[model samples]
Target: MLATTPKPPYYAVIFTSIRTSYDKEYIETAKKMEHLASLQEGYLGHESAREEVGITVSYWKDLESIKHWKSQSDHLLAQQKGRDKWYAAFKTRICLVERDYGFEREEQT
Candidate 1:
């Protein structure tokens, strides 16, 4: 499912990666990070997908929130694990979302 984000003026942390391999630990850590992010102070929402390459875009209220998430202890460990084991390569891009729009189909009974 797509993330339901607030109106404009938020931050988007786009994490794109090439995985070395997917293991049980990687799956568990990814789930943990998703849950932890949802509980954070300024987390908006996130959307993720994995195939040949993995992409996860997490939404935040501001840069401070993004920084806090980065420095979070478990997340820090996850980062190291990614470097050492999980990811062959990765790129993270933080951007200011100035404007946005989308369309959603209506639910039918």
Candidate 2:
């Protein structure tokens, strides 16, 4: 499902990663982080996809919100775990979404 974001000029944290063979704890941590993010201030919404590579994009109200999320203690731990156990490699990018448009087909009766 697409994330329901507010109007443009928001920040998006794009986390792209290649995972390791370790799967047990990683899935739990990922879900935990998503839940924790939902409880944070300035958190707009998030969407994620996984295949050979995984990508998670989280929307925020501002750069400050992004920074705060990074500094969050639980989030910090999750990051460390990602480095040590989950991800073989990863890149994070923050972008300002100045404009966005999309189309969803209506269900036919």
Candidate 3:
């Protein structure tokens, strides 16, 4: 995952993976992680997708939250499983999102 820190009021964690061929269990595990991640503090938002590669971008309030998420037992186990069975390779890139500029195209007008 290639990521750049925008400036520094927020944080972004990018998780990218090249996955091995899978069966039905993949969906079950992914859903479980998504649910678990939502319960974490400082978690702002996330986006993810996979084609030839899988990528998930999780937004956080600060570096502390990022650290916490990384160390969570379940997450750690998933990391191990990914390395051992699920992923061909993976990378995580963390960046401080200091500034952001975007607009809502949908207006209330």
Kindly give the number of clashing pairs for every candidate: 0, 0, 2
- What is the Cα-based TM-score of model 3? 0.83
| lDDT tens digits, residue span 1-109, model 3 | 2233244588888999998885446677888887788789877778888898898998888889889988989888877777788888899999977677754466576
6-106, model 1: which lDDT tens digit per residue? 99999999999999955749988999999999999999999999999999999999999999999999999999999999888999999999999999999
Off by over 4 Å in 3: 1-8, 107-109
- Order of all candidates by lDDT, from best down to worst? 1, 2, 3
Evaluation by TM-score, superior candidate among 2 and 3:
2
User: How many clashes does the backbone of model 1 have?
Assistant: 0
RMSD of each: 1.0, 0.7, 4.5
Backbone clashes in model 2: 0
User: For candidate 2, which ten residues in a row score worst on lDDT?
Assistant: 22-31
Task: Write down the lDDT of every candidate, Cα atoms only.
Answer: 0.95, 0.94, 0.80
Candidate 1 global CA lDDT score: 0.95
Index of the highest-lDDT prediction:
1
Which scores higher on lDDT, 2 or 3?
Answer: 2
Worst 10 residues of 1 by lDDT: 19-28
